[model samples]
Target: MGAITIQELTKSYGETNVLKGIDLAIDDGEFLILVGPSGCGKSTLMNCIAGLEDITSGELFIGDDNVTSVNPKDRDIAMVFQSYALYPTMTVERNIRFGLEMRKYPKDEIESTVKDVAKLLQIEHLLDRKPSQLSGGQRQRVAMGRALARSPRVFLFDEPLSNLDAKLRVEMRTEIKKLHKRLGTTIVYVTHDQVEAMTLADRIAVMKDGIVQQFGTPYEIYNDPANRFVADFMGSPAMNFVECIVFEGNLIVESGNQRHEVVIPNTQAVIDSGLETVILGLRPEMITEPKPHAESGYITQMQLGVQVTEPTGPDTLAFGEWNGQEIQARLSPEVGAQAEIDGEVQIQVDTGKAVLFHPQTGARI
Candidate 1:
């Protein structure tokens, strides 16, 4: 069984707390990603799980056994590091077989494991070459191959794709996904790239400031974030936040002489809270070129003064201002061109899918 359960996990260095009360669980064969910006203690938590770092207070269970005090080697887990950590002098074949040999496995079993891992990673032809002779992606594969040869209960990937180039990163990302599906092994991956977290994780634990801000499926974390930070951090272009004044059960957005009132689902709740100001959260894709007609009261049609347009192949990003804050709207190429030329364009905002946050606390209202 590869299921992992972490209860009240806390890691501290002197008076500084790195991981503050982290509690998460993953079933057997589940792929979980720990993601956050640099210095958020994601890597530290990974080290704790790998037994490289000791936890201050917590209980960690892998399958049925509590492995909190177990040595890393005895934990029955394999790790793939960001640096590849390959022995440069040894050939790929030796590197893959090193772990099995260190465990004193039979010669036939070692050879078979090396062959199987090399074949699975599609690096059989390159197995005779040293680490210095391989490309970045190949080196990463050899690193993964080394970890795979162990066939441990859980696989730990610590920013394994960070060293690869853009195109290679995407390629390796797909390969890792395929590998996970094929092996059906539990994987705990750590990365700061939310795109990687979203693409690769079965469930993601978004960490920040030594704490897990939210833990859920990619869809839940993206669409229904617990707080404003999660919403702002997860998206590429990011969620657009505009400070608006709540008036008469409506949120008001103003630009120059024009005014737009957006009706949100929780307008009454926000009004009842006696909060006069709220931050309106809208994804870039939610604001687009004006449709033929407004579907409901939640959809507001307004004129947006596009200051800049960025062409991103299929669609263009139109930048405008609303409520004294910059806003990005994803529009079709033709619409973007028109907005660029005309300076102002009609846009529709689907507030039905929009969210509201407390202006002071940045908490979902």
Candidate 2:
């Protein structure tokens, strides 16, 4: 009954539109992440769902009720902010019991809820401490405890881990995931961190320029992007885009004075598009050192003039140029140790995982 449904939701500020035609749904107990860069309307969309911002158009349903026009408190949603909005003077236990007390709940029931939430979040030991006395991670746990005490229909997290340090953020991320599974609560989380979205979400909605660029599972969004923007934005080092010319059912890539032909997937689709020039999208890991059994129909062996090499512990990143565009390849540490800078190395390109996009429009071909 905690499921949410949004239909063509739109929000604006006078003449400026923030969220445009957003349609999304999440089943009860699902963890949904709204992820994108700043000013992409993710936060605005979250606000609209929470009843904090009025929508210009569209319908929003939580469970079976149309709560688009309902007040924030009446919507049965709990929100956790990035800033950890905890009361300065109140003890952690008092903070968690505040909302229930305001609603005139039985004193014993409020005490039990607070104790249970504290135990679930592992903040039982810190219950008597004030917010100022706790670390960033502990304060965040308190904030989460406060939200859990309400046990609302939906939980909204607006960049909850943004203030924590890197190590603490990872720990908190795992904690949040565990909490979601244990409580079986419908969660809507917002983050600009793609890694966070990938790790924490059951489904992700990538937004940009006031519109949802793509919405899918992490694997689909990472491997099968809707457009060039989604492909470039999701990955860590980002996907490499090389300009190539389509001719005779192959993509022609040029590096220096050499020309290499790469087999294209969906030959008929590329032919039907009738676009001579296209952008080749390849993830860094797709381009790697040649293997003994790597001889395959879709594999193309090309010589790359290595310009720079970066060793990042487990894997090394090699930078080279393809068709005058700089591209990166992930190499094994052993192979990278022998890679000479400013020298040429043979690389195996996997066309099986390659994606084609229209050059001018940036549309997937």
Candidate 3:
């Protein structure tokens, strides 16, 4: 059975429509991530789901119960906010147990729950410490512990790890993933972090301007984005888009004084569409230093004037210009260093791996 169902969910703030007819169903134990830029209605949608904000239209369900009209407290959900809202006067244990205590859970049961959650979060030793004494990561964990101790029907996390430093954020991300594995609870996590969405979600909902642009598994979202907006949003360094003109069912690109045309094999639909101008999307990794042993296929080679190079430990990012637009290629540090000083580089383009988009609509063609 689905753990949560949102049907035609809509929310507006006076003149602004925050969410527009959003529909989603999350299965039991699934981790669904809502991701987008700021003011994209991710948080508003979350607030609606938590019953903190009344919907402008539509219905929501948790388990079998309709929760659109249900009170936040009565909905059987736990939320971990970005700001660790730990009680100033309460010790970590008390903060974690306060919810249970408020519900009049037996003292012994509350103590056991706190102990279990503390042990799981590896904060057993810090239970006696106040929130002021704990690190940011520790306080965030306590906030999480407070929610985990409840064993609610659903977990809502609104950028819970955003406040932590990069290292601690990664650690907490792994911890949350493990915690979800053990508890198997339905989770609705919201974040602007693409890495977090890619690493943690069972499926990702990419939103833009108050609408979901794409909703699919991480692999699908990454490899097959619905539109240029989604494609540009998900990847680090972003996908490089190069404008090209179609000539005799082949993509023709001109850079500087050179012009190269390559046939786009197997994508007949795009070729048959009678589109003249198209944008080619290629990931940095797909354009790399040409290897001597690389097999000959439909690969296209382009000569570029190296503009800049950034060495990011594992790989070096080489930047250049193609058809008057900036292009990036990922290459080995050794090769990148050599090209960096030379001011020129030979880049091999895997044309088969390239994606085509309509320049006007930004939709995959």
Please list the residue runs of candidate 3 whose C-alpha ends up more than 4 Å from where it truly belongs after superposition.
132-135
What's model 1's lDDT at 235? Answer: 88
TM-scores of all predicted structures: 0.94, 0.93, 0.94
lDDT of model 2 at residue 303?
82
1 versus 2: better TM-score goes to:
1
**lDDT for model 1, on a 0 to 1 scale?**
0.89
Question: Which tens-of-lDDT digit does each residue in 1-365 have in candidate 3?
Answer: 33999999989889988898898888989999999998898878888988989999999998888988998999888998766689989999899999999988899999899998898777999989999999888898899899988978889998887767888788878988998999899999998888999999999999998888999999998888899999899989899999998877788898779998865654576677789889888889888988777675768888878999999989899999899889899989998999899998988988776778899999988
Task: Summarize candidate 1's per-residue lDDT along 251-359 as a digit string, tens digits.
Answer: 9877688788888987678878788888999999999987777677789888888899999989999999997899999999999999999998898899998888999
On a 0 to 1 TM-score scale, where does candidate 2 land against the true structure? 0.93
RMSD of 2: 2.0
Backbone clashes in model 1, listed as residue pairs: none
Quote model 1's TM-score: 0.94
Residues 131-167 of candidate 2 have per-residue lDDT tens digits of: 9999887898889888878878999998877767888
Candidate 3 pairs with clashing backbones: none
